[model samples]
Target: MRVGIADTTFSRVNMGAIAVDELRKHASVAIERVTVPGIKDLPVACKKLIEERRCDIVMALGMPGGKDKDKICAHEASTGLIQCQLMTNTHIIEVFVHEDEAKDDRELAWLMEQRTREHAVNAVKLVLHPKDLERQAGTGQRQGFEDAGPARR
Candidate 1:
């Protein structure tokens, strides 16, 4: 089994590194990494990892800046990622941490790590043991912050 990680270089946090560590700790699968320049470049990189590198699953990690243009580009990049997933018939767990998510640097860093690591675990479950997901179904499982703990039971 193999997992792919497509990350961006423009991010302040090293989300790729965090993901690598988290994935390695949880799964024994081969990991493929592609570091792109920006959020917009992640789709092609993820496709390459899936098609060329033969990763069973992929995670697209990006941190878009807190600017108007940055937000627009992030949305465009997300759309492209969706298209890539449809074209390749692969699952891409998008872990996007917008800079505007937190005003404090410390909080932003925490959020980045929390989100990336959580998604990495999800990627592992998708390819390795999907039944784990079924167990958590409707449990309000969330990444990057406290889970809502299943909506109104």
Candidate 2:
């Protein structure tokens, strides 16, 4: 199986590289990498990886700045990614880290690394062992965030 990794150059973080390393450790799959200029370019990059590179799955990683405009652009890019998935009939796992999600630059960087690596494993599971993901259904575990289960009274 082959996994495509698409990352943006807008941010300084090396999320794509971290994800590639994580995927290599977890699964025995080939990787195709594409680096675009910003989040707005992720959809096209992912599409190309799937259509031309023939990757089984694509991981789109990016860090949107902490601003309203940045959030809007991220939303648009996410919509485009969803459409690409439908068109190609393939999975494009989006792993976005917003600058505002954390308290400071150091925290944001840490979150980006953690989220990227986790999503890489998720991508591998999607391709090789989908049942592993299904087993967590209804557990209230959201990606990139702490699990939310029933609250004890």
Candidate 3:
């Protein structure tokens, strides 16, 4: 399998680099950096990677500042809802769960709210409880069964 890694900003290059490195251990991987200018670039790069490079899976990486260093997402937020308005070709896999609030289940609601502001459109808002999101949404499309699980716990 060929996996493509994308991170828009240099601030989180370490996180994306670690992910890309780990992915390369198991399959062919291509690492690309997209600019944060707009959502258009993400999908375009994703499409090119998939169609041109034949990347089987595209992993969009971002640093939402809540989770640990290396976590990535299928969606911009933790609710597992993909922000397609930004890019059609990209798939966001994992969101950062804030370390301080992750221990409290009640905070999931707030997390969802926070996620809304992180993206530009802020249109695709979803609940952030890991259990509910997983049970209800089925762990976001494109994730391996083992890879799809609770965000923090």
- Candidate of highest lDDT: 1
CA deviation > 4 Å runs, candidate 3: 28-41, 65-153
Which one wins by lDDT: 1 or 3? 1
RMSD of 1: 1.1
Scanning candidate 2 in windows of ten residues, the lowest lDDT window is 142-151
The reply for model 1, stretches above 4 Å from the true place, is none
Model 2, 1-153: lDDT tens per residue? 999999989966998899999998998889999999999999999999999999999999999999999999999999999999999999999999999999988888888988888889889888899999899766776556677864566
lDDT of 3 by residue, 14-50 (tens): 3345555455444343444333422224555555655
Output the TM-score of candidate 2. Answer: 0.95
Which candidate, 2 or 3, would have the higher TM-score against the true structure?
A: 2
Model 1, range 77-146, lDDT digits (tens) per residue? 9999999999999999999999999979999999999999999999888888899999999999989888
Error of 2 at 118 (Å): 0.8
Candidate 1 positional error at 19, Å: 0.7
The CA root-mean-square deviation of candidate 2, after full C-alpha superposition on the true structure, stands at 1.5
**Clash count, predicted structure 1:** 0
In the predicted model 2, the residue pairs found to clash are none
Error of 1 at 53 (Å): 0.8
* lDDT, model 3: 0.40
Worst 10 residues of 3 by lDDT: 119-128
Best by TM-score: 1
